[model samples]
Target: MKAVILAAGYGTRLLKDLQGADEQHLQDLTGTPKPLLPIAGFPLISYWIEALRGGQDPIDIFIITNELYQGKFKDWAKNYPFVTVISDGTSTNEERLGAVSCLQLIIEAFSIDDSLMVIGGDTLFYEDFHLQDVVEEFEVLYRGNNQANLVLSYTCKDDETKKYGIVETDESSRIRAIKEKPSPPETASRQACPCFYLFSRHTLPCVKEFLNEKKDAPIDEKDAPGHFLSWLVTRRPVFSTSIAGRFDVGNLESYRLCNKYFQENIRKLNYLQ
Candidate 1:
């Protein structure tokens, strides 16, 4: 199996907090360019690689980050044998490509056609949850002639649901619809979509078409994956599996919360010496 991680964002919100901190500690303090943030003495992306490798099948990992951090990531991850880092180039002025577009670029660059896993660089999840199980489940669903897309869902009852892409699933565990941060009382269930997704080769063509169409369109499309996913679930089959716990380390509060959670649970993640 192959995994693609999206790490190109500038993380403007995180840098806001890091500006006042000392230059040396700034990176550790805010965890911006999230994949490079320390999780236990190692970069956050290291933990992700560990989790994916800890799964039943060995995976080839590909990371997509902006050009500036490419060297740093390469230096930090040199010891890891399976990782391959790809740079998106350094130019924030350019209207950046959305998550799916980045994935398409990686696929086209590498000529990949088998099942692929896509994840956000800044997200973390339970230590016990094996990414292999999720990948295996995707294979089962796809082999059953289900469809090309499978989204990992997490059941969050707390107030955090407002910050995520919420999902509505059918009785058989297939995703029916998804809404991004809908009004609180207007929701049907608390299951939300995390950053992890599995897709078959068939989705690539649709993604290319979507990107091309958006390029010619005048309006900017926010939440590209969600929009593409909503269409996918309606026209074809899509499956969802509930993950127990996960964290989005994109902001100050969540970054602190994730650090605390890791400290309390995963003792091995001592990032600061």
Candidate 2:
């Protein structure tokens, strides 16, 4: 299987938040990309590399980044021989290809004919997340239906519902529909879907079809991966697996919280060991 980490975002929000910060902060994060941000004494994307490296199936990792940050990613990837960094030929967020387009680019560029694991470059799961377990569950689902794809969802507060793509699943955990940032009253489901997904090889062509149909649409409609998932659940057999939680490092506050959490968790683990 192949894993693609979508890191093409320019981290404009984070940069804006860092304005007027101390000299140390500015020097540390001025040109740093989101995925390359230091978390718990390690690069943010390196955590994903450690998690995915020793899995049963040999997985090749591909990171797609913008031209502005491609050099940084390539430098960080030197320590990880298995990772391939690709530039989407975009220097700024405004000119960058959307996440859906990035995914499609990796698909066509790599000629991937196998199951693909799509993960958000700026997001990470909680301790309860086990990659092997999730892959195994996806394998079982794939056995039952070759077109089945798995997505990760976590319960969020009602007020926070508008910030994420809420997934409504049936009793059997099959995704019924995905509501993209719907108001709390608009949907009863509080299951916020993250960017982690395992797509079966049989359903790979649907991604191209989605892009083709949305060719004339605005960038907002095709930018976030949730839009693609919201469009896909209806046409494909997508299922949901509940995870403990996820950290989406969008701005400075969120990044600080994620870093603190990881630092504490790592400290506790070392103490226990």
Candidate 3:
């Protein structure tokens, strides 16, 4: 399967904390756009590439970035044979396409039709978890006549429901409702949407439909992926799978936590060597 990484955002929220770090340090320090930032002495994206390498399928990676970071991403990905980087030019959040739009761009550009895995560039996860397994299961469900997309849900231990897209699922693991940080009393469970998603070819039409309908409306928020998935679940049979571990590098506290986790667990990751 192929993976498309959404990395075009400026990550302005993380700049202050990451100012003095080197490339790799910048990545681990803030979970920002610097994919080359160091995590345990290797580039941040390197870990993801290595994890995909361990998958059963031949994983092809495409990183979407803005013009300013394209050259850096190319340089960072040079040693990885299965990775490619594309620049979306210098566009603001409003001017540029969001995660879903970037996925569509990659699909059209590469002519990809098979199942695709979409991940946020800044997310960190356990190396032992085989992302391909998720993709394979998603393919199975799709072939079994399941007509919706797959969302990787992570159980959050905190009361920070306001920080994420919350999910409510039925006993069969089918998504019953998804809210982008709904009021606390309305939340069904702590299961929240991480940045990972598996989509079949069937999802493209839904995306196109969403885009067509959204073209006339004004965007008030920046959660593009959440908006897309919300639209998909409303029209199709969306299912949820739990991620073993998930870390968000965007927030200051989570960024620090991820760095600490990596430091303590570095030896577990063979990719560094």
For each candidate, what TM-score against the reference? 0.87, 0.96, 0.87
Clashes of each: 5, 0, 4
In the range 92-194, model 2's lDDT, one tens digit per residue, is 8789789999999999999999999999999987777788889999999999999999999999999999899999999999999998889999999999999
User: Clash pairs of candidate 1?
Assistant: 40-269, 40-270, 40-271, 41-270, 41-271
CA lDDT scores, all candidates in order: 0.73, 0.89, 0.73
Q: For model 3, how does the per-residue alpha-carbon lDDT over 1-273 read when each residue is reduced to its tens digit? A: 688888887666667657645566454455346455556666667777887777655878898998767777887777876788998766565566666667777887888876677888888786555566676778878878656578888777557787788888999788878888766777768888888888777766676677777776665332368878877787788899886667776645666687777888888754443
lDDT of 2 at 43: 83
Q: Which pairs in model 2 have colliding backbones?
A: none
How many pairs of residues collide in model 2? 0
- Predicted candidate 3: what Cα RMSD to the true structure? 3.2
Worst 10 residues of 2 by lDDT: 264-273
- Model 1 segments more than 4 A misplaced: 21-32, 146-148, 158-161, 217-224, 267-273
RMSD of each: 3.4, 2.1, 3.2
- Candidate 1 is scored at a TM of 0.87
